[model samples]
Target: MSSTAAFYLLSTLGGYLVTSFLLLKYPTLLHQRKKQRFLSKHISHRGGAGENLENTMAAFQHPPGLPVYGIFQARTMEWIAIPFSRGVISAVTIGTDMLELDCHITKDEQVVVSHDENLKRSTGINVNISDLKYCELPPYLGKLDVSFQKACQCEGKDNRIPLLKEVFEAFPNTPINIDIKVNNNLLIKKVSELVKQYRREHITVWGNASYEIVEKCYKENSEIPILFSLQRVLLILGLFFTGLLPFVPIREQFFEIPMPSIILKLKEPHTMSRSQKFLIWLSDILLMRKALFDHLTARGIQVYIWVLNEEQEYKRAFDLGATGVMTDYPTKLKDFLHNFSE
Candidate 1:
């Protein structure tokens, strides 16, 4: 090679080596370096389902260290018994730092708290929650299914649906996460009203599965932080792998994801066909990487994995730099957390 060409090639190679070394040794150097506003060591999914009834006031009354996430269901000009009900007032009585609830709008444009818009699964009534006035809603079934295990049931004395306003009024000081279960404009608007009325702009977060719904949430109230939807999660994953994450701007503060729910589904009896299992397993393995968690943490974004009921999974998630583990069993999680200090 000519002298000039050789010199150019060597210089390029040396630069590449130096850059690679720096990235490997000081991984956080490229991150945004913003201080984290919130830190969640443990979160209660569905208000600690395994500990009590999922989304019930009973469940919300668990240990206080972790954040509690519940669902909202509402109706107008009527009322009914929701076994899991007790209103946000009861949840606030439990005294948690944060809470997450699902939001759905009734036919009358009232905001209610509930995980599903339909009332059949929880109440065993073949009716939609929206169609019924708050008074006409049916009581929850004698027993409710626990999210963590199959064929499990939660039985408690309280069974009445509570209004969203009740929650905002009861818990003015707490940070609450509202997961929009449906794409209803009225629901979004009603939620925004409550947030503004209570002056909880900094403490409220909007979450939903669809990107469109997430957008509506922001449009309704731009002040609160939002959780990443599935599409956003995929986009973030792509950026991370391409080394473009640090350059990209992310407005959302939380990434609440199921640890491996797609694969976890396989554990359900007779649900997974052989071929489906293999595909799910492969996908699970690929996404279960510590680097992804570490990268997001370095950028000051909180990574929370959900519905983890087992102790082993809790350890794995934390070891991989997860900011928090959302579990159905808050008592069990508290025990696990206690084990660490003792």
Candidate 2:
């Protein structure tokens, strides 16, 4: 090959490598396991009794002994730090000890908080967020249509598509749990980088997918913990791993051993059929929390569940033993925890 031809080839390969490197470091995953190992110190030998960030020690709101702290899904109308911060404030004031938030990557590669994949579903814009620039992303957040009163009332305020750094600065010491609703597998490295940037080891990265992405996040960002989502786990076990659960994969010496920090979500009822129920009788007996409690806690792993409603359910989960429950109504969960003690 001629010298000019070789130069072009080298340049092309170099560009690809640079792009790949940038994506992996978004949340800024540093290999500082010693600094950010939140679980190792807190979780009981069985992965329970993890403490709270703001008010109580654990998610359980009532004092130290009563279990169950509320894990809430907060929305950011402005993409600014205040919106995310306010959610934590609200959760705290209303008796909540813990809170949850959703994360996604913008076209410019900034990590932003958003519950929906497309802006259209929540804001009526027919575009994937991955296609828009940071400035372009802010225009839609101008007027949120949510009727929930709390978020809707704050519609006219200035909230930008927040950079992860903003959130870190606002809730520096406060503990938070983040849900990775988007399937941008490439963002794992970026998430690690940004996480290391603020040195916010208190935050936990969550997903439903299996061992692969979770392990990547944990390995890269040694300080931050991870949580697994229901769909992600099912996909890993049924199709990818061929019925073998997390430990089996790890024991087999697969590099994809399950991340010890994160917990698995169980399949919901609607997803199950009668025929399948008999085959997986054990699953039919346990809802996501029950199953996660039985599976993870027993193995000394921490687990988290999703959107549980009702006061009775909260008491039952704590009674049965769960590392955490992701709730849409943190205010309600807080109220429930308060009354249980009174």
List RMSD in Å for every model shown.
8.3, 17.0
Cα deviation of 50, candidate 2, in Å: 25
What lDDT is reached at residue 95 by model 2? Answer: 45
Specify the highest-TM-score model's number: 1
Per-model clash counts, in order, read 20, 34
Worst 10 residues of 1 by lDDT: 71-80
Over the stretch 149-198, how does candidate 1's per-residue lDDT look in tens digits? 65656665556566778767766776677888988888888889888888
Tell me the RMSD of model 1 versus the true structure.
Answer: 8.3
Candidates' C-alpha lDDT: 0.68, 0.44
Task: Identify the runs in model 2 with alpha carbons over 4 angstroms from their true place.
Answer: 1-90, 138-161, 183-186, 229-284, 288-295, 298-300
Provide the lowest-lDDT 10-residue window in model 2: 40-49
Model 1 local distance difference test score: 0.68
Model 1 lDDT, residue 195, Cα: 84
